[model samples]
Target chain A: MFDLQGYGPSLLAGASMTIAVGLSAMVMACILGLVGAWAKLSASYTARATAAVYTTVIRGTPELILLLLLYYGVPTLVQDLASLAGYEIILNFNPFLAGAVTLGLIYGAFATEVFRGAFEAIPRGQTEAAQALGMSRFRVAVHITLPQAMRIALPGLGNVWMILIKATALVSIIQLDEVMRKAKIAAGATHQPFTFYLLASFIFLGITLISSLVQRQLEKKAHRGVGQA
Target chain B: MNFTTMLEYLPQMLDGAWLSLQITGLSLFLGFLLAIPVSLMRLSHLAALRLPAQLYMFYFRGTPLLVQLFLIYYGSGQFRHELEQIGLWAFFRDAWFCAVFALTLNACAYTAEIFRGAILAVPKSDIQAGKAFGMSGLLLFRRIIFPKALRIALPSYGNEVIFLLQASSLVSIITLMDLTGVASRLVAKTFAVYEIYILTAAIYIAITYMLVVIFKLFERILNKHLRTDS
Candidate 1:
């Protein structure tokens, strides 16, 4: 029964912020990931090359550094460009927007791989069979390819979600009022750093546990009507 | 695009990178040593032995490393009296010690799981053969199981090493002047955000590339006998 020192409400608020940032970023990541996967698998050489460059650069760098760069570097670069254009507009990034976009971009590299693998796993015959049935490419993707790929992509996407949720804690460095930042403030105020931090860790663990359970359910539904054998 | 600032900060960032390498090397070695016992516990048939190991792995793996670092670095202050009474506060008080301690424990959890999987994948046939040759217990493990498992685990273990290196960036938050820490400091001081951070990212990419090469060579050596060309 460790006392939260009346900061329980703020911590809960912070947890909600963390989830908000994570979900919004995940949505962005999914969009970019889909596009990146499509680019990599496209017939266009330039598209594949650009996607390759994007994923490689993002994947090779540390997430923290990437986040910091976007948080600090982008606004500076934009301001300089604005100066060159003769407009003296000062620019500052909103922490939530920058954090979400950067996190999405960083993890989208990983999600690119996940989606690519999933797309590849879908049988070519399935696509050809849809074509034989005179289905449009969009219809084939929507009906045949996407359904199958989602089933395959579920596990990998689940993995990306777990890592991304944990990564939301790093947004605290950029001054987002997430759970980690809230815990820091509470701990500093109360001087019970261990208690608050341990509480934060448990919150993360709870999220992970619940996500995995949800993933299992999703996997089961995704696999429904298919033979167990 | 100031070349002068980039040149001036390069050496400081390199020094910070050296510290990052030191932290990664020390924690990785210590974590691997700790992982062996943890992995063995994970493999043990008894729930008493397995359950605690599973929990340890679960807790460390599930939480972000930043929380772990804070829980060790800042959190130790909460237990100052108890830790002092036990004479462990001295070590816990040092930022470097806490950084290494947290990173080691975090790495240990992931490495333990990797080792557990690799150890389980070691063929029963190989163990039985070792037993038939009068090998048992430590001898069996040393001669047959470990070497094979080392091969199985190398790829994932190499990945853990890279992850640990990247994860070491979190030590910056705890006031350690690692690569990321130094870059942040330079950014604050010079306001040459793009120049310094870009250079730092390049340095990290180079280090990651080198590690990949080194791991590839190590893997080749470990699996040398499996080569068909010979």
Candidate 2:
């Protein structure tokens, strides 16, 4: 009575949606993490303070709350801004978009710490060597600091990616039609909650398994030259 | 913009927050209890004990908690006669029991890993010293290994507590009137979804902030020996 043929398409669609959301959110988190690290490490006191507050507040709130708030609150916020600017505009919010942004913001706080630690691990001698080679400060950073820092940060970033993948499952609660939601619908329709749920968990396990393999490859590549030294 | 309106619904929200706190607390206690034995089993050299513990962690950690809750709460209904024969259908029928059971199982897996890591982290030198002092088994664990592992595990365990608190929001989906359930209900009744979500999120932020401060204090006291200036 378990009709995989009938539900196969929807379940696959859900898995792809989960991946799309997870990848988009990863890009957003990376951008936010970069900026957060910069602000935290900046010479300006206010920049440091602003980054501190951002990370602190984001860390203290649950991602579910953030997702719900953005999914519903974004349009209102846009409307208020438009009215204040003497224009009338309507904005439609998608749960996928809201979920990605919410997850991005929630995990960015953690990424900020990881990036900060990585950046701090970069030795002053390397930058000095880059400067001695007549490379400008910006060029040195682009050519030397970033590559090395990212290498150091790979393991931590991989851990975050795992967390992000699991966190994406929560998006289903907001009716995002991701894997978990897909599984729920199938369960309800077939009256086989255990079967559907177990299938969904297996799919997720497959994802995390493949992800761990890819992460191991990345870490090995990142550490290519270091083992000799 | 709807701050004043949200204020009008504050009492109900507060009650929901209290319920959330209770569920989180009770589940954490239950999970910690379950975690201790499972962690020991996981650390055991015996294959029989270790394989099942490994499977427990593998399934719980890999799956979504929402699905787990649904499977137990709704799926249990599918086996009403079987569960009734075992006298468990009565317990499984309640949303709170289902929520707590799912949360506790999930947390047990995570907390087991945390403790396993802490146990491994306990200095080998100290363990050897305990043996040298003529202590073994329970005496050694009680006098040395348990204390050190607990201290090592405290910070990560604190993060687990925060995670559990956040995860309890999922209970609302199962018909339990937690903070998120209240927010969702109010959103339905008044169509003030945005305002209610903001209020709910703010309450969570306050609770999380308090938890972090308390954990920091605990860490300070426990780690006094390592304090550079102390």
Chain A TM-scores of all predicted models: 0.97, 0.92
lDDT of 2 by residue, A1-229 (tens): 3556477788889999999999989888888998899899989999999999999878777777787778777787778779999999988778898889988988888888889999999999998999999999899989999999899988888888888888899899778999989988987888777777777887888888899999999988899988852
Best of the candidates, lDDT = 1
Per-model TM values vs. the true structure: 0.97, 0.95
Badly placed stretches (over 4 Å) of model 2 are A1-5, A80-88, B228-230
The residue pairs that clash in candidate 1, if any, are: none
Each candidate: what lDDT?
A: 0.93, 0.88
- Model 2 lDDT per residue over B1-230, tens place: 56887798999999999999999999999999899889999999999999999999988987778778888898787778889999999999999999999999999999999999999999999999999999999999989999999999999999999999999998998999999999889988987767788788889989998999999999999999999993
In candidate 2, which residue pairs get closer than 3 Å at backbone N, Cα or C atoms, i.e. clash? none
State the weakest 10-residue window (summed lDDT) of model 2 chain B. B190-199
